[model samples]
Target: MSVDTATKPHDRLAEALAEDMGRVNTMIRERMASEHAPRIPEVTAHLVEAGGKRLRPMLTLGAARMCGYDGPYHVHLAATVEFIHTATLLHDDVVDESQQRRERPTANLLWDNTSSVLVGDYLFARSFQLMTETGSIRVLRILSNAAATIAEGEVLQLTAARDLATTEETYLKIVRGKTAALFSAAMEVGGVIAGQDDARVQAMFDYGDALGIAFQMVDDILDYAGSDATGKNIGDDFRERKLTLPVIKAVAKADAEERAFWQRTIEKGKQDDGDLGTALALLDKHAAIDATRAEAVAWADRAKAALAGLPDHPIRGMLIDLADYVVARLR
Candidate 1:
């Protein structure tokens, strides 16, 4: 099912979020339109034009507004968050050799790998520049730490690929590093810049962390269950030999023949025409999908619970709804 952008859930909260994000979008467009290096604007615009949910930057803006921040610096911070996220996507496409994102050709697919990488670096540098303008050492520290964690997470996933011995703890670490770190940092910076109390800041961080985990879990589930029309290709991760949650659980519960199947397909990356069917069967037989869904729900619940101590406001309610929406597509 498609999400309705015009009439999103939690109307008032979404409106507030949209107003905050509008300033962010304007800033991103203006910053990215620099003429110093014409290629910078051209190449960066390719990825920027590729539509995404803009969830990370939205989280940053939302957290700031919810904490009573009226300053204009939130716009710069939101744009910084988006630039960082976009830069990561460019690098990720190069690493994964992915052709499609958001139902369009990835930057790496449209341009050469060198262009993707260098432009991605430029965006990173620009993001850092924007963050420095905030003059908040704590915000800088949070984002810098997140960038490091994201790198570590990517490397960990690289090592874990096709490795049948990866444990649940290692998997959690990978998810937290690769996905949740930025989410947490985005919210943390929002709180920091807003001058929120320590407890509230921590709570927002926790909320973003849980929401990100749940969001990624649903993405994993979608890879197996969502329709191709939704832009999710089934078995793509399986074909890539990436052992996500469903595959991890399925591997653990595999019987002798099932074990051999996983060994050949996941470890060796060999598969026939019916391999996806067989994998799905194994997932069903072992109830792996159900388990993964349960984990996603648990994380979503934790995200909602994290907002309990925050002051009652429409934005807080929208954040709760956004957390639910992340996992709602799974159903």
Candidate 2:
């Protein structure tokens, strides 16, 4: 279907994302409803029914369509991406002890953690099965590598938390592994499955990587700046003592007194009533938030540029807009 990019006050990019999101939604529902274990259906359904923007799967679909893929396997690949994403969310909520996602109770909150964890595994296995059905070993390798990178990233982030010595290079590695790996693999597989040339496939991979980095950077920024209404709590990362880009930058720029405060709160996990405001002020004093936003915009620009060599189409325009949308929240 052709995307209409000129219909609203918002950028046409958002509209295009919405259109691709609809197709991804259908694929997620149908695939998640498999007649496997009865309990599997119920548990998996709970998380799948929880609304998400379906951005990852849409990236897969958009990349495929933009590269002139006319086959139906794109649907299966999109579903595979969503399942992987959902599984990760289930595991993440359990690990983070988070209560809310997308303004709804997390899977671990609604069901027991055991159920959430096991169902997450089931979904991962299902994702593999779906991809294998496509019979593309290259696709399988791409996704499997992504899964490994995601796990490594999560572990890296876990290790970095509360460690004052964590470097910016380590921080970027964690984000790339945790956030951008799947995105890169998803878009790369799309072009690969479509039999696109190596350069085009690599371009899609680069685009996804940059876009994912930008997306995650914005997410980290929003944990400090966004409202609870956006489903992100202020100082959420701070409360967890997780060192994100802004926090790391602020720590580097902090004076002795500010450094002591970070040691007390982040290292000791003992936050005062005014800690959130102090953290925000420190980040502001260092211009960390602005710096982080600039980094996000740079990655997003790279994502847009990666698409320059691909063939022109409405979907290509949509992909460009989608990259823009990833960092638009910061604006």
Candidate 3:
């Protein structure tokens, strides 16, 4: 996608890091290419070419550059982050049995589950190879641990996501695994590559962690009341029977009859006509969307705050504004 001249922080960040992003994109393309297995590149390009902000990997580049690293390995790390993200997306589409992604047919729909899963594994392996090129033991440890955490988060969601008994604590753990784990890892590894002190690296991790939480919270709220874009299509989560924070809060405040409603729609997966509308009404009645939005804002604020203890580069200001822009979707 063309970068808009509009002053969106991400777009501006892209403009600022255009040269580095070019290198990262080149690395991604080169690494995704398989010399023998043509299918690998096809599947990888389908998703990679799909339009996304590349925000997570950009965060890695941003972190490294802000810390004054001019090495070529940042490109490798950024590619590693993108490959990991793409791998998870492939697996997630299979798990969700999704028909569409980024407004196109999902790989699972076009190919098969076996293809999607194996291609995702190939990407994961590619990510590890890219990470090794960095040659920092700490970088290896941080990313490897993040990969484990990300897988763990997905498994926990498998069991806990449908269980109405899932608490805020459990939801938080799941978010850290599936979403924030990568974000945090991306940032931490960026700092590590720059050889920043432990304190700075920890702050980098905190920024990514908070930003990711806010990002997911906004997504959860969007599922309840979103469009095809900003908000998800209305009630996709309901149809999936996924117990996100909004519905979880609604369930918490449910009366006996409301409990039966949740049990029927969510726990039993016995949704009928008007069930989605009913879920929306319940969420509104409980002000769950409002509460979730508030929490998202809080996390976004925390993300901006984390940057305060670090660099004073213009990119740091962009990161702060990026946090605000994420939560601004709620507005």
lDDT (CA) for every model shown? 0.85, 0.84, 0.88
Best by TM-score: 3
Write model 2 residue lDDT over 143-187, tens digit each, in one string.
999999999999899988999889889988998999999899889
* C-alpha-based local distance difference test score of model 1: 0.85
Give the residue spans of candidate 3 off by over 4 A: 1-5, 98-111
Name the candidate, 1 or 2, with the larger lDDT value.
Answer: 1
Better of 1 and 2 by TM-score: 1
Model 2 global lDDT (CA atoms, 0 to 1): 0.84
Query: lDDT score, residue 279, model 3?
Result: 92
Which residue pairs come into collision in candidate 1?
A: none
Which stretches of model 1 miss by more than 4 angstroms?
A: 1-7, 10-14, 98-111
Shift of residue 147 alpha carbon in model 2, Å: 0.5
Residue clash pairs of candidate 2 = none
